[model samples]
Target: MEKFSFDGPPVGDDADISAECQRQLLSPIQEIVKAAVAAGWSRQDVLLAMVELSWDMYEKRRGDL
Candidate 1:
């Protein structure tokens, strides 16, 4: 995985932040899907798991705010 530093000025606007967040989020999901596939999970199973995980995270973060 590549390391990203944001120690300087803002990368751009809200769109840029959203894009970066998405890229960072999907990077881990891609890895999880690959590992799950290798471990005998179907593509649909992996996708369902991803959806559930995303919703769980969203709910948790929403509560934190």
Candidate 2:
């Protein structure tokens, strides 16, 4: 497993730019997802795993430690 931080445009400035930044950040994930599927993991399984991992990151960002 690998951990990384994604820092993008600040919150609540411009919606279009914010959305575009999000799209760019998430774009690379598609290739990794395809690789995961090729490695025999179901799409749903991979999605769920990502969701769980995102929640952990969210919690930590929220200072839940």
Candidate 3:
């Protein structure tokens, strides 16, 4: 079986950008959510994705210690 890996967003050594850059990034996220809803992603799907992402983060942090 193939293993899955996730690379989380940069947390260290990344300088904070300007507010405009943040604003620009928000649009793509909004578009994807709009697309997801259009493609019939249910409330449960969203919730499950959130849970999985949180679990992955927890496991990675635990393993890093």
lDDT of each: 0.76, 0.78, 0.64
User: What TM-score would each prediction reach against the true structure?
Assistant: 0.62, 0.66, 0.38
TM-score of 2: 0.66
Query: What is the number of backbone collisions in each predicted candidate, taken in the order shown?
Result: 0, 0, 0
Q: Cα deviation in Å at residue 26, candidate 2?
A: 2.8
Native-to-model Cα distance after best TM-score fit, residue 3 in candidate 2, in Å: 12
Summarize candidate 2's per-residue lDDT along 1-65 as a digit string, tens digits.
65656666555655577577767768567766888999999988998998899899998899845
lDDT of 1 by residue, 5-49 (tens): 443333645447666667666766787788899999998999998
lDDT of 3 at 31: 62
RMSD for each of the candidates: 4.0, 4.0, 7.5
Pick the winner on TM-score between candidates 1 and 3.
Answer: 1
- Model 1, residue 1: C-alpha shift (Å): 13
Kindly provide the TM-score of model 3 when superposed on the true structure, using C-alpha atoms.
0.38
Report the C-alpha lDDT of model 3 over 1-31, residue by residue, as the tens digit. Answer: 3343433444555645544455555665566
Give candidate 1's TM-score: 0.62
